[model samples]
Target chain A: MTTIDYRLIDSTLRDGSHAISHQYYAEDVIRIVKGLDAAGVQVIEIAHGDGLGGSSFNYGFSAVPEKELIAAACDVTDQAKIACLLLPGIGIVDDLREVGALGVKVARIATHCTEADISEQHIKAAKELGMEAIGFLMMAHMNSPEGLVEQALLMQSYGADTLYIADSAGAMTTEDVRRRVNALVSALEIPVGVHAHNNLSMAVANSIAAYEEGAVNLDGTSAGLGAGAGNCPTEILAAVSTKYGINTGVDPLKLMDLAEEIVRPMMPRQQVIDRAGLILGYAGVYGSFLLHSQRAAERYGVSQAEILLELGRRKVVGGQEDMIIDVALELARKHAEQEV
Target chain B: MRCAIIGSGNIGTDLMIKMLRSEVLELVALVGIDPQSDGLARARSLGVQGPHEGPQWVLDHASEIDMIFDATSAYVHVRHYKQYAEAGIVAVDLTPAARGPKVIAAVNLEEHLNSPNINMVTCGGQATTPMVYAVRRAIETLPYAEMVSTIASKSAGPGTRQNIDEFTKTTSQALREIGGAETSKAIIVLNPAEPPIMMRNTVFAALPEGSDHSAVIESIYAMEKTVQSYVPGYHLKNRPVIEAGPFKTPGGDVPHRAVVLLEVEGAGDYLPAYAGNLDIMTAAAMKVGEAVAASRVSEARL
Candidate 1:
C-alpha cells in the first residue's frame, strides 16, 4: 500500500467563529493557535466565519475585530502558517493586504462554486502579495464535477497555488467526496483540498474519502466546533487516519488533548447532528444558515426545519442570510392564514 | 443626436439594440477590439458602423457622435473617459469606475444633465438605489439601508466579474448618497441554476419608530412605476413589508425594519430574459442617453 500523506489546514478559529457567532477574542485565539501548532498542523486559518471584512450587519459582527485576533494568532504560532479566508465581495483586496501585513501567509480566496471568475482579481492580488493563494469553491455540491473543474480552472488561471472543494453544507456523502476530489485532482496541475462541514455527520468520513482520492489538503476544526453541526473534528480525523495507516503527520494524542481540554470547553453548544443541522445537509443549505434560520424560526414561531427546507427550495446561497427572515415571515403568514 | 457604443460585449450589444429603437438618439457605431465579436457583427447587420478598432474608433469619428456610451471594464473606462471629455463628447459611463458623478435615471439623471460625463453606477445599483431613494423620500430620515442582488451567473460578463468589488462598494455608496441612507451595505450573488433565474433584489431599510409605514409603501410603488416606465420588466415582487424592531445593524439596533423585494425581467432585446441584470443596466443607460440627447437637441435649437 502506498503511504498516503495529507496537509491538514485546521479552520477551528475561522469556521468555528460561525458556531460561536463570530465572538472569538485574543485569549481564545492564543490558546487554540498554540494547541493546533503543537499538534503539527500545517496551516491554521483564522478569520470571521464569513471571511475577512465579514464583521458586518449582514454577517454577525466579530467581538474582537478579526485583525486583532489574527495578529494574536500569528504571534503565538511557532510552526503552522497563519491563514485567512476572504470572500471577494464580502472581503476586498485591501483586507487581504491588511491581514498579510499582520503575518497571514495564506489567502483562501473563496467564491460560490460557479462564480470563480469573481475571485480572479483577489487571487492575483494574493499572489502579488506573496501569499499562498488557494481557490476555495464553496457549496461544491451545487455544481457537477465537470462544472466545478471548469470553475477551478478559472482560479488556477488566476494563479491560485491550490484548489479547494468545500462541502459547506456538508451535503456530500463519501462517494460524492471521492468523485469530486478525483475529478479535481485529475484535471488540475495544482494540489486539491477539501473543507467539509459535519451537517450530515459525514465530515470525518468525507475527509478520509477525499484523502483516498488524491486530495492532499484537508480541513478540520477542533472537536468539530464549526458552522452547522460543526466541522470534521481534528482529533477524530487524526485518530481515524492512524487506524487506516494513513500518514497525516499529526500527533493524535496532542489533537485529542486539544479537543478535550482546550477547544471543547469553549463551545457554546455541543456539535451534534441535530434535526436542524441534518436538514441543512438534507436540503443542501449553506451551513452558516443554521443559526440565522434558528433565530428567524424562533422569532416568527415557525419550525426551523420548515425554514431550512424552504430556503433550500429557493436555492439561497451563502451571503443570503437576510432571506432567512423573509422565509420565516412567509411561512408564519401562511400558517396564520391556515389557522384562521 | 448621434451616439456610439464602445466595448461590444453583452452590455454594449444590448444597448445597441435598444438604441436602434430610440427616436431621440441615433446609433452611429458599435466599437470593439475584436471584429469577430457577436455584438460588432450584429451592429453591421443592423446597418450601423461596426468598427474593430477599440476606443480609438470612436475618437476618430468623435465629431460625428454627440455622446459615447462606455460599456467597457472600469479600468478601461478610467483610461478612456478623459479622452472622451477632451474630444468634447458626452460620456455616459456604464462601468463602476465612478470617474464622474453617479446618475440613477429615475432619481438623479436630471441633476447631472449638463455635466460632460455621467456614471451609471452598476446593474445592482440601478435596480435597488431608486427603491432606497423612494423609502427615504417617504420617511424623510433613513438610518440604514442594505441591498442583496441575486442575478443569474450566466448574465455576469467579464466586466461584471472583474468589477465585483466595485459593484459592492459603488452600490453601497449609492444607497447612501442617492438612496438617502446614513449607512448602507450591498451584496451580490450569482446563481448558476440551469434554467437561469430573473434578477431579484432585496432592499432592507431600518426606520425610526413612529415612521409612516403606509407612506413608505406608497412611495415604493410610485418609484416602481417610475422605473417600469423605462424598463417595463421592473416591478415589486411583493408589497413592501414592515416589521417591528430593534432590527440589528452594524451601526446599532433600529426601531423598525422595512423590506422591499424587487424582480427585473429582461425585454429580451439582444440578451435573454433571464439576463434582466444586464437589461436593466442597458435600459437605464438608454434612459439617461435619451435625456442627455434631448438636452443637447434643445441646446442646439436655442
Candidate 2:
C-alpha cells in the first residue's frame, strides 16, 4: 500500500486555551509539551487563544503570561519545534520578537480569510526573524475558493513559507474543505495546511479530505481540547492515519495515552457536541465564541443558542467577541418586550 | 488660506474633496509620487494642480501654500513633517506618526491650532476618545478605559494595515492623555462583511464607587452633539449603558463600568458611505485644518 505523508502541527496549548478561557499555567504547558514531544508530533503551538497580546478583559486574561508558557514549552520540547500564533492587529511584531527569543521556530500569522493583505507585514517580519512563517487564513468558510486563492497569493508574495486555511468556526463541510484546499494547493507553490474544529463532528473527515486534495500539513489537539466542540483530536487522527497507511510520523498509542493520562484531567469539561458548540458550526460563527456567548447568556438570562444564532445573523468575525454581550443584551431586551 | 494635500491615497483624495468645500482652506494641489493616481486624476478634473513629485511638490509650492495636509503613511509622514515645519508651513497629519500634539477636533483643536504640526490620532481615537473624555468629565476618576473599533475590511487600505501597531498604541495613548483615563487599551477589528458595515466603536470605562450615571450620560450626550457638529454621521447607537461591576481591567477592578456604542457613516465624498473609518479621519483632519487656517487668517489681521 502506498503511504500518504504529512506533517502534524498540534495546537492544544494555543487553540485549546480558548476552551479553558485562556487560563493555561506553566506546569500544564510543560506536562503537555513533554507528552507531545515524546509522542512524535512534528510541531507544538503555544500562545493565547486569541494569539499574543491577547491577555486583557476583551479576550479574557491568561492565567500566566503567554511568554512564560512559551518558554516552558520551548524548554520541554525535544523532537518537536515550538510554534506560536499571532493575529497581526492583536499581536504586533514585537510580540513575535519576544516569542522568537524564547525559541519559537514557527510563526503562524493569522487574519480574517478575506483580509490576508494585512498579514503582509507580520509574515515578512517573521521571515526576517528567521522563523518559519505560516500564513493562516481564519474562517475559510466565509470566502469562496477563488477568493481564498487571491488572498493566499498575497501572503505567499509576502514571504510566507507555508499557508493554512483554518475553519475557525468548524463550519466547513468535507466538500467545502476539499474545494478550498484543492484551490490553495493548486495555486500556491508552497505547501498548504488545514486547521479543523469538531463542532460539526466533521473535523477528522474534513482534514482527511484536505490531505486527499494535496495538503501536506494538518493540525490537531490532544483529546480534541480546543475551542467550541474541540479541534480534530491528535490521537484519533494519528490512529486513523495509521489505519489508512498515511504516514503522519506520530505514535498513535503514545498520543492516546497522553490524552487520557495527561490532558483530559486538566480540561474544565470534556469536549462534546453540546448545543452552543453545534450552533457554532451550524450558524458559521467563530468557535471561540462558545464560552464567551455562554457567559453572556447566563449573565443576561438569555439562551446561548439564541446568542450564537444572532451573532451568526450579524456575521461577526473573529476578534469581535465583545459582540457576544451586545447580542445577548439585545436579545434580553427583545424577550423582555415580548413578556410585557 | 492656500493649502495642499500630500499622499493622494483614499484618505488623501477624500480630504482633498472635503477641503474643496471648506470656506477658509483653499484647495491648491494634490501631491503624490504616482502621476496616474485616482486622487491626482480627480484633482486635475476639479481644476486643482495634481503633481507627481511627492512631498517635494508641496515644499516647492510652500511660498503660495499656507497649510499642508499630510495624508501619507506613518513612516512617510515622520520623514516629511520636519521638512514641512522648516518651510514655515502648518502641517495637519492624518497618520498615526504622532510627530506633533494629538488633536481631536471636538476635544482639543483650538488648543493646538497655533502649533506648527497637529496629529489626528486615528479613526478609532477620533470616534471613541470623545466618549472616554465625556465620562472623565462627569466623574472625578476614570481608572481604566478600553475601546474596540471595528470597521469594514474593504476600507482598511495598505497604510492602515502597515500601521496597525501604531494605530493601537496611539489610540490607547490618546484615551489616557487626551480622554483623561489613568490607563487605556485599544483594539481594532477589520470585519470582512459583504454589504460592508459602517465603522462602529465600543468604549468601556471603569469608575469609582458612587459615581453618578446620569451625569455621565448627560456628559456623553453633549459630547455626541459636539462631535456631530463637525462629523454629521457620528451618533450613539444606544443610550449609555452603566452596569454595576467589579469589572476586571489590567489596571484593577472598579465598582462601575460605562459602555458607549457609536456608529459612523461616511458622507460618500470619495469612498462609499460605509467607509466611515476613512471618513472620520479625513473629516476630523479637515476640521483641524480649517480651524488652523481661520486662526492664522485672524492672526495675520492682528
Candidate 3:
C-alpha cells in the first residue's frame, strides 16, 4: 500500500555474484547488466565478492577485488539503477560512502533482523547523500510474530527508504510470505519488499504473495542464480507480475533472454540444492543464494544437508564461504569417524 | 535413552543427524510449530526420530526421552526453556536465546551447565573467544581491546541472519568474559560476493609499552593462524603466516581471496595479521570446547 510503483530489483549482479564469484570476465557482466537494463529491470546491483570487508577473499575462495568490481559496474551507467550491496561492518563506513559517491543511486545495507539499530548510521548516511537506502533484514526466519514486528519497527527507525524481508533460506511458503510482509508493512511507514528463494520452487509464488499483501519491491536474480536452493527466478517474477498488472517495469521476455543467454553458459560448477534449502523454502530458511552451499558441498565432499548443518554449527552467517568449508570439512570428518 | 530435538530447522536437523550417527545420543522425536519443517520429515524418513507436529505432541512424549535439543530459533528457545527445565528434562539450546550459562567447550565451563539454561554462542564466538583471552593474558600490557572486524564467506545459514546482531554483541560479551577486558567491539561482515567468502577475524590488541614485541606478536599470530583451519580465519591481521592457512573456495564457484589485514593502532606496534588471527581463533575454539565439555559433563546432561 505504501509503494505502489512496484519496483523490481534485479540483484543478479549483486547477489548473483554469489554464484559467479563477482567475476564474469568483465564482458559477461556488461552483457548481463545491459540485458537486464534493456529488459526494464529497475536495479542492476553490483556487489563485491563475498567477504567484502575482511579480505579481498573472506571465504578464502573468491578472488575478484571490490575496486575492480566497482570499476566494472561504473561502465553500465544509463540502462538501470546502479546499486551496491553493503554489509555495514564488513564494508567500512568510508567504503560504503565511497560506493554512494561512485554514482550508485541505491545502497542496500543489510543487517540481521533486530540489528536495525546498528544499521541506522549507514542508512542515515545513504539518505543524506540522497541515495535510496534499503535496510535488508536477512534471513527473516522467525517463529514469533512479535520478533518479526520488532525487526520491522527497528528497520523503520533507521529511516531506510525500504525494508526487505529476505527469505535467504527460501523457507516461507506463500501464505507465510503474505503474513511476514503484511506484518512488516503494518509495522513500518516505509515500503517493504520480499526476496525469496526457489529451493521449494516457490520464489515466484512467494514474491506474488508479498505483493498481494502490500509489498511493492521484489528482488530476484537472473535465472534465480542464488544461494541455498536458488532465488526466485527473475523471468518468472517479471512474467507473473505483468500478468497480475503490477507494472514491475520488467520485460519478461528479455528477462528470460538474459537467463538463457548470459546465465546458462557462464555459470560456475555448483552443488545441487540440498533437501534442507528446498524444505526451508517450504520450511522457509529464506536463503540469499543456494549456490554458496552447493559449492561447499562439492568442495567438502558432503551432502547439502551436511553443509547446512556445518553452517549452522559454525553459526556461519550467510555468504561466509571460508568458514562454511571449514565447518563442512570438520563435519565430514566427524561423520567419517562415526562411520568407523 | 533417546533425545528429542524440537524445531527441526538447520541446527535442529544438524543435532538430529549428528545424534543419530552417535552412539551416545539417540533420536526419539523431532517437533516443530510448523509441520513443514524439513528436518522433521527428514528424521522420519531416516527413521532417526518421531517427527511431531508441535510442542503439544512432543510434550506427550517428553517422558520417553532423556534429553531435548532445542535447535529452533531463539524465540522458540526462549518460549520453551522453562518448560524443558521444569519438566526435569535436560535441554541443550543450539540457538542463542537461553538465559542460562553460555557454554564454550574451551572456556570457564566446568560447573555452569548444571544451571538449567545453557546458551551456545555463535560459530564465530566459538572459534574466536579463546584467543581473545589468551592475547589479553599473554600481552597483559595491552589496553583498549579493539576487534577491528570479522569477515567470513556467505553460506553459513539463517541462524546468522536471525542472530548476526546478537552474534556481534554475544561475541564481544564472550571476549570480555574470557579476556576480562571492557574495551571490546565486534565487527561482523557477511560476504555475498562471488567466489563466496570464508570467515576471518583479526583482533587488534594494541600491546602495552615495553612488552616483548616479537615473541608476543609471533605467538599470538601462531595461535590465531592455527584455528583458521576450523574454517573461520582466526588470525593476526595482515601478517606473514596468513598465506600459509589452508583456506578454500566454497566448493568451486567462489574464489578464496580471504586476505585479513590486522593493523594494531598505536601502542607500540600491531602484530602481523596471520599471527594475530591464529592466536585468537585457536584460543576461542579451545575455550568453546572447554565450555561445551564442562557444561555437558558436569551437568550430566550430555
Candidate 4:
C-alpha cells in the first residue's frame, strides 16, 4: 500500500541563507521558522546552509549573528520539528552537539557520494547526542545507482534515522529521481526523503517520483530559496500532494501566505523564481546555472544573462560551454565587423 | 580488496576498467538489468561476470565480492543500499539518490577507502572542484574572496540530463564543494546546437590591490597541468583565433564572441586559449581514478 500524505521540510533559514550570504538574523530565522510552523510544515531546518559550518550562519537578514536564532527556532509551535544541516568537515562536531542540546530535534549531516564517511561521523556523533540523524547527499545528479546505495547504507549504518534523496544540484529528472529513490528505498528499510530543486522545472515531478518510489519526506523551502536555481516550490508540492490525497500537513493557503509575507518582504519576486532560473530548472541545471551562465558569458564574450537566454532558447544540455563560446566568438567578430 | 559493479551506465563501466587497472582493487562481476547495457557488454568481453537482473544474483554470488558499485540510478540505488548492507557487502556509491558520501577520488580518497559509501560529487564536480579548491587556497589571503566557475552543458554528458531540468543547482553545488571557500560557486549554461558545446570552466577571483592577477591567471594554467596528467582531453590551444567576425547561429542569429579572456592583474585583457578547448571528460575519468586510488581503497577498507 503506497500512501500519499506528506511532511514538508522547510529549509528557509537553512538553505535560503545561502543566497543571502548566510546572514539571516536568528530572530528572522525564528520568524520564518515560526511562520512555517504555523503553516504546518513538519520540519524547520534551522542553520544548515548547504550542510556546511555555522560560521556562515549569521544573526539576521542584515548579516548579523544572534545566539537567539537557534534558541528562538526551537520555540517553534508543537507541530513542527526543528532540523539542521551540517556539512561534516565544515561543521564543528561539538557545536553540532550543542545545537542538538539547544533543542534541535533533527541533525542532518550533509556529504557527497564520495565523502560518505564525513556524513557518517556527523550522523554518528549526532546520534550519540540522542538526536535524530539523517544524511544528505548533495548533487545527486552526479551519482550512479551503485553509488546511491553505497551512500544510503553507510548513512543508515552511521546512525542516520533517515536518508535524503537530495538533488543538491537540482540536475535530476523525475525519472532519474524515481530510479534512484526506488533503489534507495528498496535497499534501505529506513525512512527515505526527497529534496528537489526547481532546475528543469521538474522539482515537483522529481519530488513525486521520490514519493512514488516510496520517499516519505520531501524537503522544500517556502519559495524555493537556495544557491542557484532555488528549490522546489513548497506551496506547489503541498498543494499537489494534498490533491493526490496524500496529506502534506502544509496548509496551502498558509504556505502561500508565508511565501508572500515572510519571504516577499525580503526577496524580490523575480529573484525567488526568475525566467533564467526557470530555464536552468527546466534544463535541470539547478545549482550550476549561475556558474555556467557567468563563466560562459566571460569565455564567449557575452553577458551571463544573454548566454543563459541562448542556452534556454536552444534547449542545450551539459558540456557544451565551449561550443557556445566558439559560436559566440564567431558571432561577436562577425557582428563587430558587420560581416553577418 | 574486491568490488562488484551493478550498473551498465557510463560511470559504472568507466570505474570498472579503472578499478581493474588499480593494484589496490579486484574487479569482480558486472550486473545489468538491460541486456543492451554497453558497459555490461564491455565488461563481458573482458570476461567479467553477469549482467544479472537483480540483487538475488549478487546474493547468490556474495562470496565472490566484497564491495558493490550501484551505478544504476536513484530509485534503484535507494533499494540496493539496503540489500548490500544486509548482505554484509560494503557499498561504494556513484550516485546522489540520498545523503551519500561526497568523494572526489583525489580530494577525499582516504575517506572512501576507509568508509563504505563513497560518492563522487558528479562529473561536473570532478572537472571543476579541484581547480576551484586550488584557487581558493590561493585566494584565502585576499580580502573577501569570491570565485565564479562556469561549465558548458554538453560536457556533462547524457546521464546528467535525465533530469535535464535540474542541472543548475547540481552545477552550482558541485563547484562550491570543490572550491572549499568561505564563499565560492559556479554557473552552468547549455548551448544546444547540431553540435554540442565543449565544457568550459573559468575561475574569477577578486584580488585586493596589486594581488598578482597575472600570477593568479598563471596559477590557473598551472592547475591545468595537474588535470592534464589524468584527463587527456585537457589541452591548451595555440595562437588566439584571428578576429574573423560574427558567425551565424543555426537559427541565423549573429553574436560577437572571442575564445578566452585572461585578466592579468594590470593587463586589460589577454586571449588565453582561442584555438583549442579543454576536454574535461577525458580528464575527469583520470582525475577520479587518482582521487579514489590515492587512499588505496583496500588498505583503508581493511
Candidate 5:
C-alpha cells in the first residue's frame, strides 16, 4: 500500500456553526480551538457558518461578532494555524484584513463553482496581506470535471495557494470525489483539498477517496457537527486515516474525546441522516440551506422535502437563501390551487 | 416617437424586440459597436437601420431618432448618456450607472418622463423597489429593508456578470432612496440551472413593532397590479409573508417584518421565457417610452 501523507483541517467552529444557527459564543470558540489544537490538527478554521460578515437575519447572526471569536481562538492556539473562510460578497476585503490582524494565517476565499472570477480581488487582497490564500470552489458537484478545472484555473491565476473542491451539498459519491479531485490535482499547480459534507453519509469515504486521488488537504468538524447531516466527523476521519496508515498528524483519541465529551453535548440538535438531510444530498441543494429551508417549510406549510427537491431542481446554490422562501411559497400556492 | 437601442447584447436585443412591437414609437436604428451582433443582425433583417458605430450612429442619424435606450453596460452608459444629452435626445438607461434619477415604472415613472436621462437602477431594483415603496407607503416608518434577487445564470449576459457590484450598490441605493427605507442592502444570485429558472426577488422590510400586516399586504398587491399593467409577466409568487420581528436590522432589533416574494416571467421577446430580468427592464422601458411618445404627440398637436 502507498504511504499516505495528508493534512487534517478542523472546521468545528466554522461550518459547525450552521448546525447551531451560528450562535458561537467566545467561550465556545476558545474551548473548541484549544481542543482541536491540542489534538495535533494542522489547521483550525473559525468563522460564522456562512463565513465572515455572514451575520444577518438573511444568514443567522453569530452570537458574538466573529472577530471576538477569532481573537479568543488565536489567543488559545499555539500549535495549529488559525484560519477563516470568506465568501467574497458576503465578507468584504476589509473583513479579511480585520481577521488577518486578529492572527488568522490562512484566508480561504470561496465563490460559487462557476463564479470564481469574483474571488480575484479577495484572494489577491489576502496575498497582499501576507496570508496564505486558499481558493474554495463551493458546490463542486454543480460543474463537470473540465468545468471545475477551468474555474480552478481562474483561482490559481489569482494566486490561490491551494484550491479546494468544496462539496457544499455533500452530494458527491466517492467516485465523483475521485474524478473531480484527480482532475483538479492534475490541473492545479497548487495543492488541492476537499471539504465534504455528510448529507449523503459519504463525507469520510469521499474524503478518503479524494485523499487517495491526490487531495492533500481534508476538512472535517467535531462529531460531524455542521450543516445538513454535518461534515466529515473529524474524530472518525482521524480513526479511519489511521486504519489506512495515513499520517494526518491528528490524534484520533483526543478528537474522539473532544467529539464526545465536549462537542456533541453542546450541539443544539444531533446531526443525523434524517429525511430532509438525505433529500439535501439527493436534491443537490446547499448544506447551509437545510435549517433555512426547514423554517421556510414550516412558515409556508409545505414539506421540507418538497422545498429541497424544488431547490435542487432549480440548482439554488449557497448565498441564495431567499430562493428557499420562493420555493416553499410556490409549493404552498400549488397545493392551494389543488385544494380549491 | 423615433427611438434607437444602444447595445446589442441580451438586454439590448430584447429591448429591440419590445421596441419593434411598440405602437406609439418607431425603431429607427439598432446601434452597437459589434457589426456582427445578433441584435443588429435582427435589426437589419427587419429593415430597421443597424449601425455598428454605436452612439455616434445615433448621433449622425439624430434627426431620425428622438430617444435612445442605453443598454450597453454601466461604464459604457456613462459616455452614452453624456453624448445623448449633448445631442438633445432623450436617454433611457438600463445600466446601473445611476447618472440620473432612478425610476420604477410602477412607482414613479411619470415623474421622470420629462428628465433628459432616466436610469433604471437594475433588474433587481425594478422588481423590488415597487414592493418596498408600497410597504413604505403603508407603514410610513420603515427603517430597514434588504432585497435578494435570484436570476437564471443562462440569462445573465456579460454586462450583468461584470456589473454585479454595481447591481448591489445601485439596487441598495434605490431600496433606500426610491423604495423609501432608512437603510437597505441588496444581494444578487445567478443560479446555474438547466431549463433556466424565471427571475425571483425577495424583499424584506422591518416595520416598527405592531405594524398592520394587512395594510402592507394590501398595498403590495395593489403595487403588483400597477407593475403587471405594463409588465404583464410580473406577479407575486404568493401573498406577502409577514413575520413579527425579533428580526435583526442594521440599526438594531426591529418589531415586525414583511417578506414579499415576486416572480417575473419573460414575454419571449428575444430570449427565453425564463429571462424575465431582461423582459422586465424592456417592458418597463416601453411603458415609459409610450408615455414619452404620448407627451411628444400632445406637444406636437398643441
Candidate 6:
C-alpha cells in the first residue's frame, strides 16, 4: 500500500448547513470552527448549504448572513484556514469579494461536472484575491472518469490550486472513487481532493480509495452531520486512517470527542442511510437535494423515495430543488388521477 | 428577408436548421471564429454560406443580410450588437448580454419586434417567463416569483457554461420585466444524465390571499397555447399545483402560491431531442425572425 499524506477538510459548517436547513448561527460556527481547528483539521468551509448568496426562499435562507458566520469562524480558528464553496450561478464573483474581505483563505468554486467552465471567473477572482482556489466538480458520479478529467483541466487552466471530485450524491463505490481520482491525479498537476456523502454508507470507503489513488485532501463533517446521509464522518475517518497507518494530521481521539461530544448532540436529525438516502446513492441524485425532496414529498403526500427516484430519473443537480416540488406535485396529481 | 447567424455553436446551428425550414426568411450566412466548428461544417454541407470571420463576414456581405441572429457568447454579442446596429441590421440576440429589451415570443414579442436589437434572455428565461406572465395577466400582481430550469448537461455548450452567472441575472431580471413579478430569482441546473433528458422548468409565484385559482390555471393554459404556437415541443407535465397559507419566499410570506411545471422537447433540428434548451432559443428566434421577414417583404412589395 502506498503511504498517504492526507489533509482533512471539516465541512460541518458548510455541508452541515443543509442538515440544519441553512440555519447555522454564529455561535454554532465559533464552536465548530474552534473545535475542528484545535483537533488539527487544516480547512473548514463555512457558507450556506448551497454556497454563499444561496440564502433565499428557494433554497432556505440562512438564519444569519454567511459573512457574519464566516467572521465568527475566522475569530475562532487559529490554525485552520477558512474556506467557502461558491457555485457560479448561485454565488457570483461579488460573493467572492465579500468573502475575501472577511479574510477567507480558500475559495472552492464548484460547478456541475460538465459545467466547469462556469467556474472560470470565480476561480480567477479567488486567485486574484490571493486565496487558495479549489475547483469542485460536483456530482462526480454523473460523469465518466475521462469526462471529469476534461472538466478538471478547465478549472486548472483557470488557476485552481486543487481539484476536488465531489460525489455530492454519495453515489460512488470504492472503485468509482479510485478510477476518477486516479485519472484526475494523473492528468492534472494540482492536488486532488474527495468530498463524499454517506448515502450508500460508502463515504469512508470512497475516501480511502481516493487517498489510495493519490488524493491529498478529503472532506468530512463531525458525526457525519450533513446533507442526505451526511458526509464522511471526521472522527471515523481519522480512526480509519490510523488503522491504515496513514498520516492525516488529525488526532483520532480529539476528532472522536468533537464528533461524539460536540457535533452529534446538536444534530437536528441523526444521519442515517434511510430509504431516501439509500435511494439518493442508488439513484445518483445529489445529496443536497435530500431535505428539499423530503419536504416536497410530505407536502404532496408522496413517498420521499419516490421523489428521489423521480429526481434521479430527471438527473437533477444542485440548485434544482424546485424540481423536487414540481415532481412531487406531478406525482401526487398522477396518483389522484389513477385512483379516480 | 435575408438573415445570417453570427455564432455557429449548438444554438446557432440549430437556429440555422430551423431557419432553413422557414417560409419567409432566407438564411444567408452562418458565422463563427472556429474554422473547424461542427456548426459551420454542417452549415457548409447544407449549402449555406458558412464563414468563420463572425461579424466581419456579415460586413463583407452586408447588402445580402437584412437581419442577423447573434448566438455567440454574451461578451461577443455585445460587440456584434453594436456592429449590427451601425450597419442598420435587425439583430436577434440569444445571449444573456441583455443589451436590448427582452422579448419572449409568447409574452411580448409583438411589442419588441420593431426594435432593431432584441434579446431572447436565456433559455431559462424563455421557458419560465411566459408562465409567470400568464399568472400576472390573470392576477394582475405577482409579489414574488422564483424559477429553476434544469437542462441536460451534455446540451449546454461551452458558451452556456461560461455564462452561468449572466444567465441567472438575466433570467431573473426578465421575469420581473416581462413576467411582471415584483421580486424574482432564477436558478439553472445542468444535469449530467446519460442519454440526456429533456429541458424542464419550475416556476413558483406567490399570489394574493383567496385569489381565483381556476382563473390563474386557465390563464396559464392559454399562455401555454401561445408558446406552443411557436415552440411545438413546449407542454405542461401536469396541471398547475396550488398551495395555500403563508408560503415563505425570499420576498416574504404569502397566503397562496402557485407552482408551475413545464417541459420542452426539442424539434431535433441540429442537436438531439434532449436539447430542448437550445431548441427553445432557436424557436423563439425564428418566430421573431419570421415576423421581421414578413414585415420586410411587405415593405418591398409596397
Writing each residue's lDDT as its tens digit, candidate 3 over B93-211 gives 66667466766554555646456566666555555564555555555433433343444323334555555556566666766766555455456655333333333554434344444
Model 5 chain A: worst 10 consecutive residues (lDDT sum): A1-10
DockQ of each: 0.49, 0.59, 0.08, 0.05, 0.35, 0.49
- True-structure RMSD, every candidate: 2.5, 2.1, 16.0, 14.1, 3.5, 3.0
Worst 10 residues of 4 chain B by lDDT: B263-272
lDDT of 2 at A258: 92
Q: What DockQ was computed for model 6?
A: 0.49
What lDDT is reached at residue B154 by model 2?
A: 83
The deviation in Å at residue A174 for candidate 4 is 2.8
lDDT of 5 at A230: 92
Scanning candidate 4 chain A in windows of ten residues, the lowest lDDT window is A53-62
Rank the models by TM-score, top first: 2, 1, 6, 5, 3, 4
TM-score of model number 4: 0.51
TM-score of B chain for each model?
Answer: 0.97, 0.98, 0.68, 0.67, 0.96, 0.96
Q: Write the residue-wise lDDT of candidate 6 on B1-302 in tens digits.
A: 88899889899999999889987888888999899999999999999988898788887788788898999899888866887888888989999999989998888877876788999999989999999998988886788888888888789988888888899999999999999999988888777667787898888888987678899999999988989988899999777878764665666677888888889999998888989999999999888888777776777799
Least accurate 10 contiguous residues by lDDT in model 6 chain B: B243-252
lDDT of 6: 0.88
- Residue B217 CA displacement from its true place in model 1, Å: 4.1
Candidate 2's displacement at residue B290, Å, is 2.1
Candidate 3: TM-score?
A: 0.56
Docking class of 2: medium
lDDT of 4 by residue, A1-340 (tens): 3433666788877777655655577667766877888887888887735443333101111244323577778875567888777754344466677787778888887665434654555676788888888887766766776788897898888778988867765667778888888888889978889888875667888887788788998988877776567777788888888778776656888888888778868763334456666555545443534543554456546565555555555544332333345445544565567853
List model 3 lDDT by residue over A1-340, tens digit each. Answer: 2333578888776666656655545666778878887887778777653424423233323355554666667677566888777776555456666766677788887765545555766777788888888888776764344676786677677778888877776666687787788777888889888888777777889888888888988988888776656777889888887788777766799889889877867777442455666644544333533454566577657876666654553443454443444555566677788999
